[model samples]
Target: MKLTFPIVIAGLLAVFSSCAKIEHKKIDDPAYLRVFNNLNYTVSIENKDEEQPFLAMLIDPETDTSGMPVSAAIVGDFLDQRDGYAPPYPSHVGSSNSFKNPEYPGKESVLVGPVLNGFDLSSWAQIPSGKHRVMFMFRPVNNTPFFQLEERLKKKVLIDTVLQLDSHEVYTLHILQKNFRTKKNGMVLRQEVFHKMPLSDSMIYVNFYNMSADGFADADISLKKRIPQSGLLMFGVKDVMNVWFSLFTNDELRNPVPGYRFRYMTSLRQNNTSNVVQPYYSFPLFAANGTDGIRTTAWQRISLMVPGMNPENNPYNDQAPAEVLGNYAVISCYGNGTKPGFERDILTVPNMIVNIHSGTNNPQSFATVNTIEIVNGRAYLTTIQRKYPTPIY
Candidate 1:
């Protein structure tokens, strides 16, 4: 099937608004249907403000011809490392002398989940002009005789023509999966090990496309909300996002001591906010790893803190810990002076939730929260801001 239409610019006066009209035209073509391996993903629709209208579609691979969606319930957040120390290295003592000292490192622990819930699509379609999409994929656990996983790996999801708007609508025609699929199981094992490593919990990618006959254009992501001066928010699938750190031991174990440094960095920006806030912290801890690797089995720990009901009243002390909040944390990353992670990489978690301690003065008590999710290690977040229609540039 093929989709065709003309995107009219409306008069030479040329103005762009959140609620601009969309026109689409469909032409008859060959009736052959194209199919591929199981396609799984989440699609979101937003109007002009670029927020709201967030929707999730889990294509059941077994019967969903469109593609099957991996059950998000199985994904959980769990911490595997806490209060752990780093490997030991040789240090210079007196002139030309080398010495190794016993050091300790410690980290708190927490677990993410097997289930990711709390999503709403009603608001997205109501926005003036906001749309977005989130997708995820997971290979079945080994030795488990689950037919669903087997079926998901065999189906292909296609994006031909979306029926949301009837005019000037360009359908993204492609079948894609976020997770890696290999015939060999060894690669999967490598991925498992890498998953247990201390890498950044975020991924960034760029795509170039032809939106019109004029030429090719590049699309970038940025955070759309104003950084909150107070209150707390959650990021990540509370159950599955995990953090890990490893330690190695050498021959300096005489007295047996452990110590290390700690540092924390956090950032926040609100929708349409002109500025962002970044803060950093430092601390110390103790860690110890036995000479035997047997004693060094994998461990789970909480890397962040989750906020409480009265988080606002204690704005200064209301911050959620890393473990309870999971591995998700706002960073200083930006695009052209704009926060990028929220719009493209981390939109699945609620974007921004206003905390009204004494109660809200604006009747629009409707809080604006962005959402972010992960698929194959990539983060997708979205933000929507409302503003007066500005003249077309």
Candidate 2:
């Protein structure tokens, strides 16, 4: 049967022996379907029809015990995981450089939940490898102290668009919200890893993910150096988008050279803010892995603490930097000049993978891919600048 937890999960006591050292690898098995959630709402998957159906029981309203919305049940599940040292726990653990999640005795554990952040990846939930139909359900509950506005709670379902799985490939079934306001939700897939690639080379590949609700359906990713200007990689909100590019940096230059740029625009400016004509947005990061193999400052791991990136309260204090670094870069589209992340937020946002060396745009925000890029050679990169009390020239 398909694995589905109830309001109170039975506990998958599969604790990691060492949280500090995680070497991600997929165990050899049949094709798997890991349900990846990137939404603020708690959810349940029903109407799970397939050649061999995966059965999961729902909280029957008639015999419900806790008397809470199914959505709330999921939220409750997330709350069960409390630790100052682990990932996915609440972002407030009175922390220092060590044990951000506040490692308590017997606190080294994780759980299954319907609601998840873009970075909160789950283990691959096994499924028969073939075409299948499944429906996602999310209930808008605004009572929590999270970022849900009065009108933020809107019910949604990501229709199955004929999901096909292969035994050799593990896929992330995720939901990327369009704008926080409109109901333009989409299901996008990211191949977490490819076993085909050699171990040494896989660590160097970089992939970019646009989770910002900026309303642009697509984005252009480019890496340029003075000698050979590499063409930009195209990414959209749909499909399984993964174009791997490795950054071969010299040992001296530990961090990837900064010449990375992510650009996109809002389809409708009014949706983002009540007052704003500038719908265009862009983010340019200064860190980089030098083009040649001789540069001293190579790309090393960096962390980013983004505010307002996740709707609830700001998450800089308690949450730890993402492990997806070296492979992922998350761009936050939600930010205002008056907001906390206005000035010093970028300092918290660094390029580890998703949140590493994060940069924001008054017009929009940008980050690196799953991997960082070192521009080949210094070339004149065109940019737009606004004149005081005048149009951007």
| Candidate number with greatest lDDT | 2
- Model 2: per-residue lDDT, tens digit, 1-393? 676675225443333333345443433444533333333222224212211111111111121254322332111111111111122222333333432111111122222112222222223344445654444434332233221323333223233245666754545444444453353555555444433333331122232333434433222122111111111111112212222111212332123334422211122111211111121222223234332321122222222212113222224324332221112222221111111222221211122222212123122212222322111111011111111121232
Worst 10 residues of 2 by lDDT: 375-384
TM-scores of the candidates in the order shown: 0.19, 0.33
lDDT (tens digit, per residue) of candidate 1 on 117-153: 2212111111111122223223222323223346655
Q: Can you tell me which runs of candidate 2 are displaced by over 4 Å?
A: 1-29, 40-122, 140-161, 179-181, 191-193, 199-203, 214-343, 347-393
Model 2 residue 320 CA deviation (Å) reads: 27
Task: Name the regions of candidate 1 deviating beyond 4 angstroms.
Answer: 1-330, 333-369, 387-393
Please name the candidate that would achieve the greatest TM-score relative to the true structure.
2
Task: Give lDDT for model 2.
Answer: 0.27
What range of 10 consecutive residues in model 1 has the weakest lDDT sum?
183-192
